[model samples]
Target: MTGLLVKNYGIKKAAKLSGVSEYTLRAWERRYSIIIPFRSESNRRLYSEYDINKLKLLRKLTERGIQISNLSSLSINDLKGLLNRVDSEIISTDEKYLQLYDIASVDKTINDSLEAIKNFNEKKLLLILHRAYKKSNFLEFVENVLFPVMVKIGYQWKSGLLRIAHEHFTSAVIVKFVLKISSEFEIKNKAPKIVITSPDGQHHDFGAIIGDSLAASEGWKSTYLGVSLSAEDIATAVNQTNSHCIFLSIIYPNDNPRMEAQLLELSKSIHDDVVIIAGGNAVTGYKDILTNINAHIVKTPKHFRDTLKSIRNQIRIDKRENYEKKYL
Candidate 1:
């Protein structure tokens, strides 16, 4: 082997130097071919210094909201150029300039996404979402772009400005985009698992799709049981996956007594240790029941994000305690 190929860095060292977890490094390799380390005679992977540096760069960019999918094909020089732009933006202390730059990019994204939806152009809609995803973090993308656009579409559809076909088209496009992005995220096998679904009769599933996508972004292994699932079926899935948490999306048709009973059944069926989170427009109608059952009721998208953070933190604490019990 040439001197340059003297792979001195093992996976742990590479991960340490790159400011990423060993699992994330492996995932990047598998998903994006970001770096394919050499195999030793013993069949163990070994990364060279160059591979370590490249991974470091990728980690920095991805943390700043750039998608790994977009960076996989770029050369080192191209990567550096992008990094330089991010650095420039950070170093500038001029509040006015920063504000304008931020506003322009965000406004453009929202406007373009709305126009694409109005035109019922699925291709353009997906492209716009991709661009937004690249520029903003998942939370920002959902809040500024997805939420606003969906609200506008709903309003127009209800006000007789847009036909039913338009609402259905928009829903399909959004669901497709969310599912595609969720599938792209890689979660460690040992990461906390989550189950996302809407109960039977709650046919509106956009909230459920987005909820699962958000969980996946936080490195949670999410078992997404699509809409219209029975209480027994959801409980079965939770048991099957050994999920740490469950998120239920409750939309219209809020006054159903049967739905209330289903929620109660789910709360009773799942293990007490599992966290239950319920959210959506119709959730308010069952607040008393959810409270009695010790289920979390997220009133808004932002609240849902915050609740997931708490859940992830709890998962970390549980893992640490288990690790101590086993080894320390």
Candidate 2:
């Protein structure tokens, strides 16, 4: 299909539209010849509507772990085919991955939890969550059970499939349970400290709670600061706690006018060494502010875990350096 054939865009516009960086786009054009866009009279590359679509598809596939080299030779139709196989898309992991979480059982648990939420059956919901918690490790439970269930509940509430009360009820239960479970772990003396919270105007705290649990799992002494704290208060808390890092979870209100101001305030208040790790659905809205703060934007749980590991290594290295300098 000839898409927007009359209209063409410059590389920057194409990058913004396609969600691919300009450098990557240039490299793909030069090295891989992924798309030979129209060259203007001044030799500036201009991407057509078709080129933008191709770039967007490429971005989506690459995000899902497909290599650009493998995809370079394929036609746009092939890319769509790879993406459209929703029921049979191939996963990159080994058989052990499949065995890690029994999909059938996890789905059943998710459904059971949803039913309990619908019925407002507190006892049954807690029992189900407890069983899932006992059966799986922290990451597995969060990814396979907790996240999926909460996401569906969110959608249902948004669609008016369920009452606001049900959503609040589920949130209350999960928050308490997660805090209780996370508190069971004894923070080691050497564990890095981190404060997990959502910024002011962001009401959702589930992401912060999960982040707290995950940080604890990664040997970080994470204090769950809850949701909707002003930037100044967060800065004070971080300073008081002497936290090694701050994790901000932005889940809802993707377009708050004050988001940029809040992020800017937080960045100004915190120490430069205090790393800010941001994640969740709404982070994209304040991308420019986050960039200015030098925040690390983690896209997945695995990425978050890897970032934590790197920070921990850096902390140890610093400590060792201090010891050697004192004695040597």
lDDT leader: 2
Q: What is the C-alpha lDDT profile of model 2 across 10-121, one tens digit per residue?
A: 9877865665656678778888999888888999889988888788778767655578898999898998888667215543222323333345345789889989999999
- Model 1 is weakest, by summed lDDT over 10 consecutive residues, at 91-100
| Model 2 global lDDT (CA atoms, 0 to 1) | 0.79
lDDT of 1: 0.78
Per-residue error (Å), model 1, residue 50: 62
Clash tally, candidates in order: 0, 0
Sequence-dependent TM-score of model 2: 0.67
Give TM per candidate: 0.65, 0.67
Q: Which tens-of-lDDT digit does each residue in 1-328 have in candidate 1?
A: 2665568888866754555556567767899898899999998889987786677678657655689899999877788899889867753222322343355455777668767867888999899888888988887788667766766666678888888888889889988888888888888978888999998989998889999988888888988889989999999999988998899998877787887688889877977567788887788777777755657677556667777786676567657766877999
